[model samples]
Target: MATDKPCKNLHRSPSPAQCMDHYGCIYENNHLITLLVDPENGRIADANRAACEFYGYSLRQFRQLLICDLAADPKSGVQEFVEKALPAGDEQSNRMFIDRHVLASGEPIDVEVHTGMMKMLGKNCVYTVIHDISERVSSEQRLRESEERYRDLVELCPEAILVYSGGIILFVNKQTERMFGNKKQELIGKRIEDFFNEVYFQSAEHNKLKTTGLLKERFRIEQRLIRRHDNRIFDLEISGVPVIYEEDKALQLVIRDITESKRELERAIRLQEHRHAVSFPLDSKAVLEKLYIPARTLSGDFFLFHKINEKQVIGIIGDVTGKGITAALNISALRVMFMDSLLSTQNPVQVLNDLNLKALQYLGEDYIAGCCFLFDFGTGLLKAAGAGINEFLYVPRGRDCERITVKGAPLGMFESSEFEEKSIPFESGDRFCFYSDGMELLFNSDELGRDYGYLIERFAGAALQDDCTWLGLNIQ
Candidate 1:
């Protein structure tokens, strides 16, 4: 609403400024949606031809809406300030105030409201000049929603996802926020290179992973991520994949914490090497040796050794379910438990009972297959027990041989799996061979895949614990 101030030309002289209502278009560039709003509720008192055209309605239709309906802000201060200038003298009302006007169809039009003494049929009437701001508002809303959608999805994804282009992180997810120890908003537009160590930035693997994506098969790599606070260091398994983002090609990185697994692997590697080197050669003509090899860095198959007598030994070859770090840890625990038989009980049944007790204590639900053997030199008595383990061969000197039957289920498979040792007379030139299920079968019958039985045949007679253990005893 445009209001008029008191006539300051008190001398009764016909001043030209007071006689003529001085007004023009609010904005020179815009002509549509021009309307004079009533200051109380921002209703259109009058609308120009351009204002009617811009609103997609006639002047009569434009008069039905209020300014508050179109502008996001319901309490528009621009309207209140314009009404305040009406009581002042004409000198104070000479200036203009910019205001936003709401149209009939819920659209806001910006206006520069000029105030002056207006004589319309000899009565004071407020006439407001409006400028259509639809293009500006629509553009701003589109931009805001676009940015918000991306930002929200990034934070919501469970994966440690990040959107990085060139060097900066355009977006980061909630998991990534936790992993990096920073807020997603704080990381936006920040250089990702700063978070990575110099080695990662310098590595060829990083380049290949980022540039070529999964097809390159170089997605996962260990990297160092330093926390800004307290200088804490954490190991991260970083996987970068290439993506098309915002009309530009970019890289999305998923970082996983691999600190615990990495430490365990380093420990297992050293221990496996030590376990292989521990079996040194002796002067005895009759001795048994076993070896094991896993395709991965760790194997489930391992053996426990004990000196049963001055010239004889007792041992058990074990293969726990699975062949990664989890199985390796369980196998290590089993080895420690197997050696405690001397301190606890020498009975094969008791040894197995104690192992189950320990497995129940530490292990979850993983199972194991094992072959337990005890030898006595004084009586030349060789005792062997099978618990889920099969493919055991006893080759004698005169073409007589024996094979072990699968008797018991895998250890840890049941809470009460037991063992019973079977004795055999050991004459000179008798041999006993022990092995894991790898000797049984693994791959499907495809020419390209590994034939597990064929592999066992090729590696059955290998060295003593150099790689994998396949114990062959030439009993004398």
Candidate 2:
């Protein structure tokens, strides 16, 4: 895209002194830094204003210096440039190379040099154009370092990491070999389907479709796979993110073994079902109406009611910390403690205190939030105490529901925890509702439209979420 021009005409024989003045004007206004150099001795014959500004030298000073003096390694580079530019038959040919040049301030810079032969003052000379490429070189170095860091990070990760392109394995880390029971080389360039059995291939196909549909997005799934070395099937939790590999779309997968967690989940479900099997009497006199629903196979909520004597009945509703098997175990332990405490003492405050003291024996760092109540139909007196049960609804005869707020801490946290017993007068038509905290999840949904009329207005059109348990008793 560039053309060469000689000072005056090539056939003219102007004086060498006038050569600089005439040639200088020709290249002074050129955008590129331009210089005319004697190819035989490497001496600069003339320099344009742009070259003077670029080298931080005046025209008189720059013309005194040799072309080789500008290069970082002057002797070797200048020799090469002179040899390449002075070849006899290549008068119009251009030679290009990259070299380091020293700036006027002694700072070093990278530049691309374009050199071509020219005739000036009836003598052979070379014209050179220099372009600064320091930023470009620096950018390329940074990109190389960034790619190296990425590879190092992926290789050292604890979880199995893999990169796939076009549905084939393109890369795998050291952990992948350990996890899949194969060498890293064995996975490269192989199709992902080659690693799994037919049953697992079906699941992998489905997952592949999901991942492809979510290009440039992130997703996670749990599935079972058979280890190639041992034929052992285990659960794997795979997380994938779309990425660019060599400028093409690819998927990066991180896999973790979750077989133990899956087994624990199954065990928790069975324990939760068995522990919650303690049923309440459905008779009209004891518990009039009841509803219980667990959010998952394992519930962290429970409700229990037992007749203390002919005239009195005791009941408790509790929400335990956490979910799954651990929560179920704690709920079962708390149930036993609650039964023992109430049987020994009818005072609601004393019963709560006893359970709190015994909780440390069976529970770990977990706590129980609950309200306990005892009703005596003979004396028309009802006593209630709570430890961290925030919502308790009391409905008076032919009246709306009201919340009973008991300021107390959760059981099992502190040995010095205390509970205050609240007493209310009970009448024939007065009804009391006892429920676990999770019951609030369904308070606003159509699922509770049958029993809770006041909540129908409060939680209208809301979705059911957490576990729900409710017990209602009407004083006879």
Candidate 3:
């Protein structure tokens, strides 16, 4: 029960002479703990029945105790009140205060004291009313602690977190501070219009109205906003939720930065298109016909055919260990290495050996399966080598295409890796096919599995499923 009300509302005993007139009709009740005290010496003149029961004391014992005796910290609050609560010529006659008080069992509890000046039996005195507020104060303290933890969590979050009401900022996390390059103080009470462009401002307004007006609980969007310091705009993925903050409806927003990822995606698109739109110079005499199909946006299959000199022309086809951008990067590295090696030597074995060493040095765990061919127009002899690749196809002037057996380990695997070289006497009307494993390993149809044996039956024409790169050279 709380009794921190006007003492006049409490029942007063007639024996307390001065209080009898003001509280005579009250006449001893237990609902309120009321007290009459001599203000000059902080002495308790009288206490009602409720006060005696509340303090676990008899009426006479209560009257013997001073007002300061009830306080746990007498010096901090009680002494100050006794000296200044009712100074001379003070028009402010009433005072209310909260303090911790000790009960009869020596246990402390929170209390609110309402005090007012009064004339009791022709002498100045103060009336006191007490209320127990321990439970209420404890609940408030717990709420404060919970709020502190919530604030810490928001401050330490990795993504930007913001709370706003009516498009006005209310709170911003540390990540939001760093992202916008502004302190939380600068953002609080500010509108989104200060940071975002007009387009984003309209979008935010639209989302808020859609969420609050339509009773939507949450919404998400991707947009761009400018940084505060440099005014550089970047992409953001924003997620918003409706919440009550500071007793007012508000919006909670979480922002994720996606500028770098978006840029990388655009760059990859450009690279993939560039790689797909490849153009090879026409070679009317070599009878070169190439076919390339990519399994993805970027192809793991790559082929290169260049005329090294009048006596020799080098052609190669390869498949990197994996697909997509990683394989594409490795293919680029292979092209650079192959071009560098071809500038000095035309031997298929030496060229492959050089590439193998470079692959081992730079390609890490990834490897390349490739076959190299050097055609000598001057001598009508074709030299061939392979590394981690399937057999090459050879067609004589009037003979069926046959697989040429070659031996080599995959590049980037070992330092002592070797490639086998074979020479075939070439005639004027001969054809050779060089292709990646995608051709044989690719699924053609469920009826016929990935068997290169089918290639011998349909050497003239065969369908491919996986990424395939093939280069054909007709001996001129």
Candidate 4:
């Protein structure tokens, strides 16, 4: 039951020191405890029922203790907190402070201490209220650890991470400079839509396209912007999503290099056309297949098959190191050298020496390394020789392979390294093969799924699936 009580100032009896626990006294009793000190000295002050429960100290026990005696911290952490919280000029006021309290049983508890100034019996005094907030400290520590873990995860991603809001960049990872060629400081607060093409920027289509992963289709366009420092345009593709940021929607973008993908697509298109461009004149016995894999857009392998005489057929096979249009150009020059030297019935070695000198005159010292093999099908005799380019050899199983060694220094290596020749007999049904370093490097990846090498082997001994020339030399 609850009752309205007369005010203490209205001639009511002085309040008892013990907690009343009655409804009328509940609010005051919650923060009050009896004073257990002697009258004159004010030796000690009793804690209230709420304070007793808070500090795990009994009212009688608390009344025997002084605040100064209970507050001395044996541990440095507590003392440091008290010093920062309770500076000078803070004694008599209702100062908010944190302190450590050692109870009668010697257990220490952390507290937020609130002090109130008071005057009792014409003596100056202070009433203190202690509240525990240990759970808050622990929760703050856990929140810090969770934030650190999230930071570490963001740092470890291989691609460049960009955090933005409302199309303006807010944060960027270290890889951003490598991918976008811009410093993080220069990028923040910059509109991300500036990087998008005008066609996609008008309707914010680039921003929407990433959600569907379709913006990558315009990776070709990103190649246009050159970096300020090196003038090297990045072959980068970006994917991004919109998220709530600072209570508003922001976008996060991630970028990856797609240069190799662009090159592969170009090569695929060229190879499709090259397949029909080169072939033997008349069909013979063996099914001829050649696999041509250029380390770049073009390759170093070239061949030509034509009638040398009324009854004789001539065939040539060559491998050149270093590629692109340059190596392809050297392959073209080799054909010219073969035509010029072929009329003399000279050895394959002489033809290459002539070609090497021509390549040096045309391409300088960095031109190419190569090997050339020729066969006169009328006599079934095959002659082979080479320059610096090796690891490329022919293996003709069940018959003479006509193995050839890299003889001279790579064609572009020296102005003059002698070309030496070797010969072997070729028979019907013999198969010869050549390969580039990219062919063997195809399988060197952590991801062990289908790869370039796996696809090449599938066409092995059946028919080639690569872009190169296979001169079919057989009897009609």
The runs of at least 3 residues in candidate 2 whose Cα sits more than 4 Å from the true structure, single-residue gaps closed, are 1-26, 29-31, 35-75, 82-97, 114-126, 201-213, 281-299, 302-315, 323-368, 375-388, 392-435, 438-442, 449-476
Error in Å for residue 144 of model 4: 26
Query: What's the CA error at residue 255 for candidate 3, in Å?
Result: 1.4
- What TM-scores do the predictions have? 0.51, 0.71, 0.49, 0.42
In TM-score terms, candidate 3 sits at: 0.49
lDDT string, candidate 2, 68-136, tens digits = 788787556556667655555477789888888897778888999888887876888888888999999
Which residue ranges in model 1 land beyond 4 Å of their true spot?
1-161, 164-207, 210-219, 222-236, 241-243, 257-261, 280-285, 294-301, 319-336, 339-350, 361-368, 376-381, 396-403, 418-427, 437-439, 442-469
lDDT of each: 0.62, 0.75, 0.74, 0.54
lDDT of 3 at 435: 73
Q: What tens digits encode model 4's per-residue C-alpha lDDT throughout 1-476?
A: 99999877886565544334343365346654333332233345555567666557776776766555666465444234333434553544446776666765677766676655555445555555567666776688798999689667777778887776555677778777556567778788776544434344444444453243332232212333444455554466666665555565555677777667666556644643473366654355334444444432455666565555543445555555545555555666666766876776556677667766777776665554455665566677766666653433344544333334556666656766787666666566554443432333443222112223554575455422333432333333
How much is 122 displaced in model 4, in angstroms?
Answer: 27
Model 2: weakest 10-residue lDDT segment is 441-450
> Highest lDDT among the candidates is held by which one?
2
- C-alpha lDDT of candidate 3 relative to the true structure: 0.74
Of the two candidates 1 and 3, the one with more favorable TM-score, higher being better, is: 1
RMSD each, Å: 14.1, 7.3, 12.9, 13.7
Candidate 1 C-alpha error for residue 437, in Å:
4.4
